[model samples]
Target: MALISPFLPPGTINNVPQPVLTAKTLSLRPWTAGDTPVVFAAHKDPAIALWHRRRIEGLEESQAVIAQWAGQWEKESGASWAVCDGKGLVVGRAALSRINLFEGDGEVGYWTLPTARGRGIASQAVTALREWAFDAVGLKRLQLTHSTRNKASCRIAAKTGFAFEGIKRSALRHEDGWHDMHLHAAVSATPSG
Candidate 1:
């Protein structure tokens, strides 16, 4: 009998594998419609809009963003988890976007609610997701790029063991102008079992 299931092309999965990750003080689960309100609240933080480069208008737009995230998971292109507190309030978000299964690569990003900042929650979520991406999703490498000005994100990346790779010049544009992106990456040292 074959140990592996029938192998399909990497990017062809119809739905993302929803996995719940637990940490010292966080619950990371797939985003759902019920999370729209909390997502809106957290996203309303001015820093979120500034760093993430998008404005969330209200619950309606928040719902749309969640739907879009689901759609991306279905297309095997992206996935996000709502980072929740012990009380189940969404305090942040962690996501792997621009997933190229064919290339065995993906990009990671994260943010925390204003209230959740300074708790080391982003780094914990990133650590959990990194293990999932490498061992469970069987991805070979994960990358993260943030505006050079976002020192907080750089700190989280370092804390989570994503080695500093380099920077992309003026690779992303924001409300102000183009910004350089600092790149960091984590590669699996062991071959996929």
Candidate 2:
């Protein structure tokens, strides 16, 4: 009789892995309904209102945006995430949209709660998301738009390795007048691990 192996274990199955991302004391994860309160407050913050699109007036509007984001994520064509602090409180949002799959391009957008500003959180979040976009999403280029007067966002773009492309005339209609938008881009065609 042939000798049998002593207690050979059978192959075990592996469960699907959970998506994870980190940035200093902050973490990035897909947006969810639970983030509505934070989202509402952030939208109403004066700093965000100065350069952002129309303010989300209430919880209902916030919830609608969340639903839209969820649908976009399900389509696997666009993405947005809530930025959470060490305490796991959603402090803001970061998004990559207008995804052009054929060209491997997308636009990056972000905002931070007023209390979280000046902490380098936006810069850190953008950098982390840029890496994820290039590596996980196989994107070749990422773009950003900054209002000419929004010095903070322009600074963040520079700090995050995005090169200033140029300015687009009448890119946005603000309270004053049509605002020129500064374009910034990062081309990740070079191999990155």
Candidate 3:
């Protein structure tokens, strides 16, 4: 029998897996107090602010953000992993957000520290999250969206096997202005490989 069906329950997100998903170069795991410095540094990068449209103002806020990241799993609204390198230093982040359990859908997003770019870190982190979302968490559909201008993000989504869906005109409001977004998605019914 198939694992996924259209008749999933509304609180299916209660099953969000908290396992540490390991990739070839990354260990996607829960956030901790020690990750505060890395989180602060990543958000301080202007490019991250430009793309994500949110920035951590100070150490306190960074702590709060880590706390919030931890709380997301319990709330069943989202789950985020600290993308750490072999040394256990957080080089990036990956998250499944906007989770709708009744609909079995979630949105995936990620950001890498400036030092980690061009190393394929973001794509690997995303791939790990995608696998857990489908195979472990039982999420049926995962969507990824990025600004049309974000070429790197687009590439990461494609590299992770998220098929291009379409463009959402003025889909998001960033500090600069309203911007169009490119939508991509993956469904659990299909084999990623």
lDDT of each: 0.87, 0.80, 0.88
Candidate 2 lDDT by residue in tens digits, 1-193: 7464312111110121224568888898877788888888888887787787669989999999888877666554567888889999887788888776655678999999877889999998899889987876667789999899899999999999999999999999976689999999998965532
lDDT of each residue in 121-168, candidate 3, tens digit only: 999999999998898767789999999999999999899999999999
Which is the leading candidate under TM-score? 3
- Clash pairs for candidate 2: none
Candidate 3: deviation at residue 165, Å?
Answer: 0.7
Query: Global CA lDDT of candidate 3, please?
Result: 0.88
* Candidate 1 vs 3: which has more TM-score: 3
TM-score to native of every candidate shown:
0.90, 0.86, 0.91
Predict model 2's lDDT versus the native: 0.80
Off by over 4 Å in 2: 1-18, 191-193
How would you encode candidate 1's per-residue C-alpha lDDT over 41-136 as one tens digit per residue? 877788998889888889999999999988888888888999988998888999999887767788998999998899999999999989888877
The most accurate candidate by lDDT is 3
